[model samples]
Target: MKPIELMRAEAVNLTEDPDEVCGYWRGHLVWVKQEDADGLWYVRVNHPDGGYLYDGFWRAHRDCTAADAVAEAFRGAELLEDE
Candidate 1:
């Protein structure tokens, strides 16, 4: 079994929308707004051809760590998104 790998990145709160600041993660396609609070976070993976592939959105709370929540959310949402 291979361990799951995640690419973590951060962005500022230009607005209240997580997708706006993290828009770069979606290759500027505008990722779906997952959650917005203090800062913005996004997940983008490289495609087979080296292009960016938008995974989804992640909502972070001030009380919790965004990285952990984002990773867990992505892992859980991966299968649902594929279906």
Candidate 2:
């Protein structure tokens, strides 16, 4: 998607699972999961262009909300565009 299109795109959830959630935001894939041990959220963002921000791995958001995690992924996507 074009940068402008991406910037305007809203996140779309792909699953209804309670423990895990997957969505797409501005052409980036975002996955958020709650850890069974600590109940913290794990967020991962994957861009189609493949950037250093995510590298196809999950990052602990540590007490962050699902919306915050999604926002974080969108921020990562924006940063990747700056590169």
Candidate 3:
């Protein structure tokens, strides 16, 4: 599927459940999980081999929608394509 299609699909899934993330960023496998902090969300990026990448978070949940949080996580995702 195209990137836009992926984005829309991911966004829909996120909207359904902010903590559900069976999605991808670029070609990287990703998942959205909840953090211990209130309103804190985590986008878990990982290696194709199932290794750890980094945590992605945004504290602006104060005035944001579920889609907003997913978008924020997308912003923090690393694009792995080469130049």
Whole-structure CA lDDT of model 3: 0.53
Against the reference, the lDDT scores of all candidates come to 0.37, 0.54, 0.53
lDDT, residue 20, candidate 2: 65
Superior by lDDT: candidate 2 or candidate 3? 2
What does candidate 1's lDDT look like per residue over 1-83, in tens digits? 11122222332221223233222222222223335565344544434355544464454565544334444434543522543
lDDT of 1 at 61: 61
Over 12-43, each residue of candidate 2 has an lDDT whose tens digit, in order, gives 65653555657666566667666654546565
Highest-TM-score candidate: 3
Model 1: lDDT of residue 53: 47
User: Which regions of candidate 1 are displaced past 4 Å?
Assistant: 1-39, 55-57, 69-83
In candidate 3, which residue ranges exceed 4 Å CA deviation? 1-5, 9-16, 34-37, 80-83
> In model 1, how many backbone clashes occur?
0
Measured on C-alpha atoms, candidate 2 has an lDDT of: 0.54
TM-score on alpha carbons, each prediction? 0.30, 0.49, 0.50
Q: Residue 61 error for model 3, in Å?
A: 2.6
